[model samples]
Target: MTMTDQRRKEEGTLASLFEAERQYAPVPSGDWMARMEALALEEQPAPRPAVPAAPAPRRRSGWREALRAFGGWPAVAGLAAACATGVWIGIASPETMTTLMSSDSSSLLSALDPASGFDYAMLGL
Candidate 1:
């Protein structure tokens, strides 16, 4: 067949298919469109009054403020000195520590034993 004849056949088939579709299609009701138009035109109701905002509570200045107000700079310095002394003693003294954390090095090695399932052997122990 010629190319012009093939093109004409395809156009005829497409037109028939479109006509069948139009024949089976449902027509739109006028009342549905009118109702939709009325709904679109209708105004929404006014919103309700908003609740009054709550007042913020006054905040306390806490321990630092108390230290500044009553204890003063000397008290603060004494507290800081005591804290430093406690830390120094904790690092230097062995007897003051717990038995598990004492100068006994074997306790740490035994705690890392593979028989206990921790497998320190895998780390070349």
Candidate 2:
């Protein structure tokens, strides 16, 4: 057949297919929609019951409260560090402490009695 004849035949087939689609409009019934809604609600999870709140905590006193005021254990550790540093310096010092602790009359008496015109710088220390 000619090309014109084939094009006309295809156009007729498409026109009839669209005409048949326009003649029908399928829709769900009211009872079907109600049933669908009811099914949706039934498929949902159940709600949980309400729970009671827990009781309040007890109050702290005496040493426990005092410890909190001192910023807990870390502050105590800092205080211990300071005390240790002081003790270490006092024990490890060689020059001033050694001269001060000497039982010799001149050195000990001179270091104590600042009125004796004893200048620590005179020793070239």
Candidate 3:
């Protein structure tokens, strides 16, 4: 049908539904409250018996507990990477350590500058 006919039909159906709903008067407040109280009483759990305390959880190994107590795998990977970097700088290349330590601030800045075309691999650091 046309849009206007469809709209009129929908409005009529909605009004009839609302009228049907309105015809049923609500339960009295006193009756409803009493029913709700009765239902609540019926649904209450019976008292549970007191039981012995649960056994203590098994203790994990010191390192395993420490790992979990701290951040887990991501923290571990970060620490591993930092240690590896430290070891590489300390033992693998003494020259790199000296160069980094001896270099002035300006040279450090130049190394960081992308426009200067600073090649880290070429520096052999």
In model 1, the Cα lDDT at residue 125 comes to 59
lDDT of 2 by residue, 1-125 (tens): 89857765777868667657767867899999999999999999999888898788887789898888989999988998999999988888767767678668767766677555446457654
Q: lDDT of candidate 1 vs native?
A: 0.73
Looking at model 3, residue 124 earns an lDDT score of: 58
lDDT of 3 at 118: 49
Ranking by TM-score: 3, 2, 1
Instruction: Please give each candidate's TM-score.
Output: 0.24, 0.29, 0.36
Judging by lDDT, tell me the better candidate of 1 and 2. Answer: 2
Record all residue pairs in model 2 with backbone atoms less than 3 Å apart, i.e. clashing.
Answer: none
The TM-score between candidate 1 and the true structure equals 0.24
Q: Enumerate clash totals for all models, in the order shown.
A: 0, 0, 0
Q: For model 1, where is the 10-residue window of minimal lDDT?
A: 112-121
Runs off by more than 4 Å, candidate 3: 1-48, 94-125
lDDT of each: 0.73, 0.79, 0.79
Best by TM-score: 3
